[model samples]
Target: MRRGVRTEEMQEQERSKSGLLLRGRLAKELGQHDEAAKLFGEAAALEEALAQAYAAQGISEQVWRHEFSAAGCWFQAGNFLRSLELCDKLMATPDAPETLRERARSYAQTLRERRDRLWTELLQSEHTLVAA
Candidate 1:
């Protein structure tokens, strides 16, 4: 295969991941949470596979972004733990951008705080309801 053709093929595969990621984002924006979650999960798997493949070729920011977006989709869907795992993975990689690392840190902190507060409120409300 010509080098150019091979590069095109790789890019095409990369784009398939991106397409699914975009579909998930769009579906979520349209209030189709279930569809969005399914698409996001598929996109996440594809992005993860692509990231590993590209890592073997060389560290590439584009591949990292695919993984980032997949995780971000989960974050947007309130899957904080999964998103935190992805963020931690990205942040630990030497290839990740400083900005991305910082953002991931910020997001992880926010998610932790938010989930805690939400649970606290829920517990308090439940306690009150039980007493009533």
Candidate 2:
């Protein structure tokens, strides 16, 4: 019974995660950037929570996978710093899977290359935030 319940919970969370990602993409495609960002952030939070649940169960692979997803969400939301943080966390983990570390390294490199453009966007948003 406990196992069944856990499976159900995981399935439900996966469904929700998928929905959020789809909705975020749609919003982005529709030019609703702020809405897309918010949706992506929500997706990231959900992924992080799921990662914690997996960690509590000693599911190392799932934990890193979820963290990788959360990083992607942060990237979609233009939260470069947060995305990079997750990538760094994965890369720094001695016990992390080799594939995960390699992926993170690749992602970190891309993030570095886009840093200037992302920084400009951040500065613009900052001004808008300050004005409002």
Candidates in order have lDDT scores of 0.74, 0.89
Q: Which ten residues in a row have the lowest lDDT in candidate 1?
A: 1-10
Count clashing residue pairs in model 2.
0
- Show model 1 residue runs off by greater than 4 Å: 1-9, 121-132
Q: Of the candidates shown, which would achieve the greatest lDDT relative to the real structure?
A: 2
Question: Which digits, one per residue and each the tens of the lDDT, describe model 1 over residues 1-132?
Answer: 111122565677778867987898899899999888888777777767766666666657755776677577666656778877988887887757899888877877887898899999999999999999
CA displacement after TM-score superposition, residue 106 of candidate 2 (Å): 1.0
Candidate 1 lDDT (Cα, 0 to 1): 0.74
Q: In model 2, where do residues sit more than 4 Å from their true spots?
A: 1-7, 120-132
TM for every model, in the order presented, reads: 0.71, 0.82
Q: What lDDT score goes with residue 72 in model 2?
A: 96
TM-score of 1: 0.71
For 1-132, candidate 2 gives per-residue lDDT tens digits of 012124567768878999999999999999999999999999998898888777777778888999999999999988999999999999999999898899999998999889987788999999999999
